[model samples]
Target: MKKLLLIVTNIDMYASGKLRTGLWLSELTHIYHSVKEKGWNITIASPKGGAVPIDPESLKPLVLDKISKEYYENPVFMDELNHSKSLEEVKNDSFDCIYLAGGHGTMYDFPDDTNLQYIISKQYESNKMVAAICHVVGGLLNAKLSNGEYLIKGKSMTGFNWFEETIARRKKEVPFNLEAAIKERGADYSKSFIPMTSYVVADKNFITGQNPFSSKEMAKIVIRELEKV
Candidate 1:
């Protein structure tokens, strides 16, 4: 069985503290169920660990999907969120892949976690896969290869684009523009011409999805890459 490390944001609010923000529920649930169905073992971890907040907006009827709704209602699954391991606890564990699940909160915490940067660099340098979706791709922004070069430099990838952020009406709320940041790191970023549509990119050991809607397809890509190994 394959092992997956899923990293989520521990942040419950944006920098402003007025808007509630946290893990985008579907980004975790969509990929979790996709891989779990294959009987893969998964461990959820966060920068600070403990209970991870779910963006309240994500649970709203119009935004919540059936799969996410099911998991949100499952006590067992909710327990996993409530007791997520800290990155410090799993720094030495080996996993076939490390997946970063996105939410607006990721913009604040994902970019600066030293543990996350090391884990991503180590995983990629080992030739294992590192995957991320939506805003959590911000986590990759600061991860550097052992050579001191950025991990994303020159990689073809996609994340939650600025357009989507604007469409979501969070352009001003997010600390930085995610699409621009990815490009600044020299990643060849791209997104769906139609906002919120599924768009995924696979480049060598890295796989990225454009937005929440892209998680399932991104998981399919991750499973395929693992099989190739």
Candidate 2:
């Protein structure tokens, strides 16, 4: 069976030191179910590994959907989250794709993680699919190809937009402007005209989503790419 490596943030609080944050549960469950339905195997991992944190805001009823609710109630899935593998535990080339799930916490850990960057760069270099959604795209900002060029350079991609931060009232809490950071790295960033709408961009093996709303769509795109291989 094809395997997918799903990366989630280990950080549980925003840089502001007051606002709580962690992995957006929906972003992981939505894509995870979509891929699993296609008979694909998935391995969840995090920067630090044990007891993944779920953002409190993500558990609110306003944001909870059927898929996420199901995951929330499933003990087996919750157990998987509690025992996620650490980056060091993952074997190179063991996965067919690498997907980074987004949340406010990703901004704290993803970009500067040398091991994470190395894994992503290696996957891309091997012609495997590399995808991320929302703030998780932060991980790609510093990833370097074997040629030493930034992985996102000259690639068209999309992630959490600056405007969304403003709308979500989290502009001050987030560490940096994710959209601007990727643009500065030479990504041809694009997004929905309206904030919080589902928008996904596929550039070869690189698939990116604008926000949590785009998670399932992003997974579909990834599945399509996997089918072609």
Candidate 3:
């Protein structure tokens, strides 16, 4: 059976300048359901071993909507979130694809996660799909292939943009600008005209979503890539 490894960054309360957990329930729900619907296996992992916290804002009905409400009500979904495996605990070759879910927390931790980067580069070089949404793009910026090139070099990808970061006051939240870091990695980055609109770009095996709104769309495209594989 094919597997989708969902990599979520852990919250860094002090480093994040507040609690910054992976925007998990919305994304984990979408990717898990979508992959399971396609008859694919999914596994959840994070930078830390367990106790994956969610953003307070995302847990609200106003932002989460009906589907999210239904997801929270599911025992299976809640259990997965509760028992999320740590990235240090994964056996990378067991999965066929990897998906990085994002939040402001990712900006703090994902970029510097060398072990996660190693896993991602290993999987990608072996021809597995690597997908991410929002600030999760931080992981991609550091993954280097055996040839020593940045995986995203020359790839057209999108993420939380510079302008949106400004609008979101994320500069006060994170140590660096996500857009600048992505641009430094050599991607041809672009984004939607409005806040929180769904946008994704597929450049070879690298698929990226612009924000939380892009989670389901990114998962669907990731399935497409896995099928092609």
Question: Judged by lDDT, which candidate is best?
Answer: 1
What TM-score does model 2 achieve against the real structure?
A: 0.98
Writing each residue's lDDT as its tens digit, candidate 1 over 145-213 gives 998999999999999988788889998799999999999999888888999999999998899999988
Q: Model 1, 128: alpha-carbon shift in Å?
A: 0.3
Predicted structure 1, TM vs. truth: 0.98
Candidate 3 all-Cα RMSD: 1.8
The residue ranges of model 3 lying beyond 4 angstroms of the native Cα positions read 12-21
**Alpha carbon lDDT at 211, candidate 2:** 94
Candidate 1, residue 139: CA error in Å? 0.4
lDDT of 2: 0.91
User: Residue 84 CA error for candidate 2 (Å)?
Assistant: 0.6
For candidate 1, the lDDT comes to: 0.92
Compare candidates 2 and 3 on lDDT and give the better one. Answer: 2
lDDT of 2 by residue, 122-197 (tens): 8998898999999999999999988889999999999999999998899988889998999999989899998999
Give the TM-scores of the predictions, in the order they appear.
0.98, 0.98, 0.91
Taking the tens digit of each residue's C-alpha lDDT, what string does model 3 give over 1-229? 6888888766745374564545546766677777888987878888886767677667876678567778788887877877889888895457888888877777767887987889888887877678888888887888898999998888899998877778666667676788888899888988988877899998777788998788778878888777876
Q: What is the lDDT of residue 136 in candidate 1?
A: 94
Clashes of each: 0, 0, 0
Off by over 4 Å in 1: none
